[model samples]
Structures are given as structure tokens and as C-alpha cells.
Target: MSIELGVLVAIAGLVISYLAYQLTHIKEVKTDSQENAEVKAELGYIRRGVDDIKIDLRANEKQISQMGERITRVEESTKQAHRRIDQLKGGDQ
Candidate 1:
């Protein structure tokens, strides 16, 4: 009867140990899920920052195009002025 009692105690200890291990494993899974959520949130912020940069870059490109057009118009006006000046000089001669 003593030997049988000892065997029962040993079996109960093993079952308790297994349950404890399973509980710890569940806690680790929860922690991993939290870490995954944090990583996903960080990625979302980075995506938004990249999108903002793209918008700013497009705006700068448009402004540069407008400046180029203004410069072209100024050059055309200068050329016309020079031609008028040359005509006046020819009449005086």
C-alpha cells in the first residue's frame, strides 16, 4: 500500500508540473502578441511619414515648373526690348 501511495504522488507531481508549463507558455504567447501589435503600429507611422514626403516632393516639383515658365517669359520680354533698341539705333544712323 505504501508503494502504491508513492506512485500516485509522483504521478500527481508530474501532472502539476505540466500544467504549470502550459500556463507559462500561454503568458509568453500573450507577450508575443503585444510585441507584434507594437511593430505593426510603428510600421503604420512610417508609412504615413513616407506619404507626407511624397506630397511635399510633388508640391516642390510644381513650384519649380512654375518658376521655369516665369523665367522663360522674362527672357522673351528682354529679347523684344533689345530688338526695339536696335531699330531705334538704325533710324538714328
Candidate 2:
């Protein structure tokens, strides 16, 4: 009878110890408000970064458009110079 009781007590002790360990190691979930706040901050940061990128893209696009216009003007001037050279050489009109 004594040995039986000792065995039961040992088993109970082990179960209690396991439960205590689990309680200590359990992780708590973040509250919805905290999660939302973090998400909102991240989104705001990303939006600002995206806005900056859009500004840079617009500036680059304007520069590219100006360069294209300049190239067209240069081509027209080149054509005119060629016409003058051909007239000097007595080539076709």
C-alpha cells in the first residue's frame, strides 16, 4: 500500500510540474489595437517612400521629354545643313 501511494504521488508531481512549465512558456497574442497600430505605421512609411519614388520618376520623365524635343530640333538642323551642302556640290535639288 505504501509503495502504491508513493507511485501515485510521483505521477501527480510530474503532471503538476509539466503544467507549470507549460504555463510559464505559453506565448501571449498581441492585442488587435497594437497590431493595427504597427500595421498602420508600416503602411504610412511605405506610402511616403512610394510618393518620393513617384516624384523622382516624374522629374526623370520630364527630363527625358525635354531631351527628345532637343534631339528632334538637332535632326532638323542637320537636314538643313545637308541640303545646303548638296546645293554647293551641284547635286539634286
Clashes of 1: 0
lDDT of each: 1.00, 0.91
List clashing residue pairs in candidate 2: none
- The CA-based lDDT of model 2 is what? 0.91
RMSD of 1: 1.7
Residue-level lDDT tens digits of model 1 in 1-93: 999999999999999999999999999999999999999999999999999999999999999999999999999999999999999999999
Candidate 1's displacement at residue 62, Å, is: 1.0
Candidate 2 structure quality by residue, lDDT tens digits, 1-93: 999999999999999999987766653234666788999999999999999999999999999999999999999999999999989888654
- TM-scores for all predictions: 0.83, 0.61
What TM-score does candidate 2 get on C-alpha atoms? 0.61
| Residue 73 accuracy (lDDT) in model 2 | 100
Please report, as a residue range, the 10-residue window in candidate 1 with the lowest summed lDDT.
Answer: 1-10
